[model samples]
Target: MKKEESFSLEKGEANQELDDDGKPTRTGTWLSASAHIITAVVGSGVLSLTWCLAQLGWVVGTSFLVVFAAISWFTCILLTDCYRSHVTGSRNYNYMQAVKTNLGGRKYKLCGIAQYGTLVGVSIGYTITSSISMAAIKRSNCFYKYGHDKECHTLNTPYMLIFAFIEIIMSQIPDFHKLSFISIIATIMSFAYSSIGIGLSIAKIAGGAYPRTSIGLPTRTDISNMDKMWNIFCAIGDMAFAYSFCAVLIEIQDTLKSSPPENKVMKTATTIGISATTSFYMLCGLLGYAAFGNDAPGNYLTGFGYYDPFWLVDIGNLCIVIHLLGAYQVMVQPFFAFVENWSHRKWPESGIVNKDYTVGCFRINSFRLVWRSTYVILATLVAMIFPFFNEFLALIGSMTFWPLTVYFPIEMYISQVKLRRNSFTWIWLKALSFVCLLVSLLAAVGSIRGLVVSVETFKVFRSMS
Candidate 1:
């Protein structure tokens, strides 16, 4: 029994080093955790928030953001409870293990699928968006110099390949917890682009460039109300995308200061992260809507066109590429953990674990070089082929939001924690989880419809132009 336990522990978590006080040394503060959450939540999704606003108009869109924020906060609280219950002062290396610990292997399979798929989707989205943002800058310059019929040479394919090479090299880091510095930079880059977007919108409004109006809605009563409602759900998916950090929560919690990563710290970090991100989302969404009104583009910054002050627009897009570079790392590192954990179990005789101090450990090892590079390259090729950015975000959000963000956390809490059976609180919680599942179903339908529309509308094999 003792030998079996030792093997299981080693497979479950590689890093179990004790501190000088004979206690498990925790590494991150509430602030760093919050920063990591903020970094995850506030990425390229913010770029399409104006398009969300355009879908639902100002009143409905802003309300949806606030609602999702509240839901997300509550989800975090549930996660903290699960961590305390399942972990109970022990080390938990990843979210999958946490789920399997509480809910067993059957549930763990679903959670693992959703978590890994969601992270891959996010990384692919960033790759596609980063290259598109870069190409937008080049297109802007081409249009400026060559007028409306500019045959710009810069397509997303080459840039996607370039970013894949860069990201694959950076992803050679073995430990997910050590990504805190990169997450910090990602958080700052998020703010940089969001603030710049807000500034530009404000400048446009103050300069009498923006006229008050709403875009993407029909004025004609002849159009079906179904169309409007579908758009509303699509917008909800966008807001959900903007607010999703649950997929990365357990990985982020790996750094919490309190052993077992206590509730107060997680709650404080959750509140801070959610509040700040919501504020930024609302600001950018509202201002961008006000600035562009009914004519808002799907991506506000790129859609700004190569008019006057083109340099500022170009800089904003460049910052997005930089931000996505960091955000891509933040999102994919957890996936890397999942991969490495599985690989180490398969080849236990080999040293396939994190070597923090070894110089060669950080270099491009054959396993990492092959697996990670292949992962990035596959994502890049997919993005290059099917470049439907906003719809893809919504689709990924709808697929995972309920399972990862709402359902899994709450169900695991009920399963693991000592909740009174048949009590009102427990009943209410069950009902809420059921409702979230229904919501997820609705969002999935909307996502499929949105995806179909996007595919039909977007230029496939676009570089073939």
Candidate 2:
């Protein structure tokens, strides 16, 4: 059979087909792609998005969300275009493979390292945030009044260790095909949580349970004119930083069975996923800010006072844990592969166990055991020490996310389009590249401003106390 025919046949098998080497073929239906993309995009960002929006009021906040969505959508399209242009024809053209081939040696390695680092930072942030949310739920009046006294409002070291153990075991399961099913359920739960919470908050505002804040044009008190411009710019930057996961998107594309055609399925799925996420962010932000008014909490979802009727806060916590675990698996898998490859390169005749041990748990191989042990220990120490999920997330977003999402994409565009002196049709790509760079820079500044402001505010409160 011709190679093209073999490729087509493999595509027909979708995610189930294995190549001669026993690797699963990347072909997948729209559902699989959508699930992977949505899960990748929706992480701990959903938790604090509302608070960011509240700072600008609902109208402005929603507007900001729309603009951000457009930019993200455009960026994704451009990225897909780049992938199609540079990497589609080759049989081995996956995301990282494409980067290695198109961008060449050092750039690919640097981007890969940055990508891995960002994912690890994000995973740590999510784990810590989820634990805090769980603690908060336990401390709520409902749990304390109704649950077992010993279980309520207690942070038991043993329990945490057990939880960590369970998470690790669950994460080691080899059936990645099942991830799509799990992601679908998680996405549904997220939608339900957002809908119910936003609806209830809106109802309360309408029924006069909470006073509605004026939502017109900005005022001097809202922020100085100079600060308003800065805020708007910063808001855009924050949104970019929050949504930046372009590297992950490349992975999503590579997972498809055939090279993605410019077909309806890909277009429709991408549109729906991006639109829904942006709308969810906007609604959650507006209603949350409106609900809290001037007393709006810094963490939108959790800080919204009163009980969540659907037990959403709890479910949200669980989802965060699950999502983080998945992300951690993806982040670590590459390093594991690299290490195994290195060992095999040195000792070419070793048993498969020596090479495959990195993929699973077993002490016969010291590398697997030592690395996993180190990760767990370091992650635990960080979570225990810093413990402030929001600040940690902000820091990661500023340092790691901005670099990967904005800086890398701009660099990729410049290398692929500008350096090649590509056609005039590529002008918009250049414009977008510039916009991403500008947004990333401004976001770094805003995040620093926010951190400093928080410190100053804390000092004032302490002095007063």
Please report the candidate that would top lDDT against the real structure. Answer: 1
- How many Å off is the CA of 285 in candidate 1? 0.4
Write candidate 1's Cα lDDT for 415-436 as tens digits. 8766889888789988877876
Off by over 4 Å in 1: 1-26, 86-88, 147-154, 210-227, 259-262, 351-364, 457-460, 463-465
Number of clashing pairs, model 2? 5
> lDDT (0-100) at residue 298 of candidate 1?
74
Ten-residue stretch with the least lDDT total in model 2? 456-465
Clashing pairs in 1: 215-294
For candidate 2, the TM-score is: 0.77
lDDT for 295 in candidate 1 is: 58
Residues 1-465, candidate 2, lDDT per residue (tens digit)?
578766665454554456422576655567776776566566666666665564566676677667767866765665554445543444323345556656778877887676667666665665565565555455454553665343344462333454456555544433334356666765665665567557766866776767445474345475677665555444544455456555566655555555446233555566777877777877777777677664455455555324544265555545555555554454444444445556768877766425444334432454454555566666655555444444556556655544555555555666665555565645655666566566556666765565565566453212110
